[model samples]
Target: MSDTRRRPRHVGAKLLLLILVCYFLVPVWWLVVASTKNAEGLFAGDGALWFSGFHLADNLRHLITINNGEYLRWLGNSLLYASAGGIGCTIVSVLAGYGFAKFDFRGRNIVFAMVLGSVMVPLTALVIPTFVMMSNAGLTDTIWAVILPSLLSPFAVYLMRVYAAASVPDELLDAARIDGAGELRTFVRVALPLMRPGVVTVLLLSVVSTWNNYFLPLTMLSSSKLYPLTVGLGLWTQLASSNNGGGESLWNLIITGSLVSIVPLVIAFLTLQKYWQSGLAAGSVK
Candidate 1:
């Protein structure tokens, strides 16, 4: 009798999930197919959504060789900004969250409420104010302009606080305190291990956010040398679109470069998705 009841739900869920998978994968599949085509194949408009010819290698060679390999520099800059900023953001969020979750100080509720409220505010709204502050601090048009603003994510902080409250046991912290462990030491040695899933989850979110950031970098960086892949690719597309001459056909490079840029993010997400899933599922079963 239970089997009969469960069968419909299972089948329905699988159908829903299959639809979602196709919804997301179709765009990626189109990108992959489009990336392998040259200008003629792409603009031919007949096989735009499928693999008509394999010119991926030729496109990649042109991408790498363009303007003395500017794409590689952009990729490296993205890695540095995303990795460093993500790690820094995770550390700050975890510390602030732990302090909030474990300790009871002045304005605790009010402060947490404020943090929650801040999470509701979009980063886009704050960009102009942030730019002004960065300008006053003489940080405009520098790497710090991009990196400093990314070091604290209010959403991550709220997430960490909630996860730490549930996942990290008070008993373990008390035991560590009893053993002459300072708050920092306890957090580093005992509490952090139990919250690995949460940290990894926050870290990956930070990485993705930093990787796809375009407007801040666009406003802060005036030099082509410091541009990340997002800005650089946009610039290339703009330049190509404005010029109709045969010498300036760069749609293939832009498409191929975009495909290459997303590869790292895909790898990182696939590698860390298990930890993120575990974090989300932490208290569900219990």
Candidate 2:
């Protein structure tokens, strides 16, 4: 009886896990297959989940050469936005989190409460107001319009605060202070090293956030030259579906571009996964 009960639970757990695995992996498998086909092959009404032809090379060439190589420019813009904005956002989060976690200031709790409250608020709801403010500042349709707004991330700040509190010890900071180290010096030399895991985590989060950002860039930028990969691909997708009876449909390009788009994110995680893992371990070491 005992073995039978345990066996059923184990089977159920494995079945549930298999379902989840398929749920995520199936789309990826379909994309891989769909990306290898032309419009005819893609919408051929069969074998979408199975590779039917080898058009990956041809699709990639068209992807890069289309619209006079605008895709490359869009990719460059995305790189600039995600890398630069992520770095700035990570730094701000770390500093703010460290201050919040370590220091005792007037209205500290109140300020943190407000920050936490902002986290509960959806970023989508703020786009219109953010756009209005950017418009007033005369920054619309420029790269700055997208970059400036992403610099401040409330969620990253909260993560850093928790990490700083847990990873950094007050006694060490007090010792550094007694040794005549300035606040800035202590943070740079002492606190930062101790909070590496948290910093890495926040950095990764910020990068991913900026990378996948579509709505803000869509609303802020109007110039095609300044569009990032997300917005650029979206425009192509729209054109493909616009049904103007163009020379050929662009569903292949869409699938292929999307596949290309995710490559960076996959590379990012693969490159940083070890560091992220280390950071997580450090954060949990206490």
Candidate 3:
């Protein structure tokens, strides 16, 4: 009787998991199929989720060669923004989180409370104010307008704080201090090594956020050359749907560019997966 009940529960869980997997994967499958089709095949294809033709090479070639390689410039811009913002944000989050977790000082709780509160605020809401500030500073339409803003992530900092507190021990830190290690040495040699997983996690989050960020960059930058893939693709989508000029011909290129845009993010996650897993294992052992 107990075995019968457990078997049914297990089957139900598997069914639910399968549903979730399909829900997430189906769209990706559609995008993959769509990228291989031409303008004609995209609308009147065999099926939306099935390949209609193998025009992927043509689509990719067009994607790179169009408008004097504007797509490639967008790709390079995205890489630059994501790399700079991710690394900078990760460094800031790690240091700030380590301090918040380990340090004792006046008004620490109050300051942290503000940081926590900021996380509750929608990022879109801040875009206008941030844009205004950038405009005032005469930095609008420049790379700094995007990269500088991407550096501060309240949730990343909060996540890092929680990870540092749980993963790094006060006793261990005290021992490091007692061993004549300076604060910087202790952080670099002792605390940081233990927080590897959290650092990687923050790095991935910041990179993905900056890479996919559309509204912020849109509001801050007016130049097409500085546009990231998100904004660039969004522009293509607008043009393709507007029913004006040669916009309709860009549909296939849009789909192909999107597929290309995601490759870096996939590579980043796969490359960092081992470090993330190792960190989790280390945390569990501690």
TM-scores for the candidates: 0.94, 0.95, 0.95
lDDT of 1 by residue, 119-143 (tens): 8888888899999999999999888
Model 3's lDDT to the true fold? 0.91
Could you tally the backbone clashes for each prediction?
0, 1, 0
Top-scoring candidate (TM-score): 3
Q: Can you write out model 2's per-residue Cα lDDT over 139-250, one digit (the tens) per residue?
A: 9999899999899999888888988999889999999999999999999999999998788888888899999999999999999999999999888877877854243567
Give candidate 2's error at residue 59 in angstroms.
0.4
Per-residue lDDT tens digits for candidate 3, residues 1-286, read 9998899899999999999999999989988999999888887846898887799999999999999999999999999999999999999999999999999999999999999999999999999999889989999999999999999999998988989998899999999999999999999999998898889989998999999999998898889999999999998888888964356578889989999999999999899998767655654655
Q: Estimate the Cα RMSD of every predicted model relative to the unseen true structure.
A: 1.9, 1.7, 1.7
Model 2: lDDT of residue 83: 95
Model 2 segments beyond 4 Å from truth?
1-4, 245-248, 278-286
Clashing pairs in 3: none
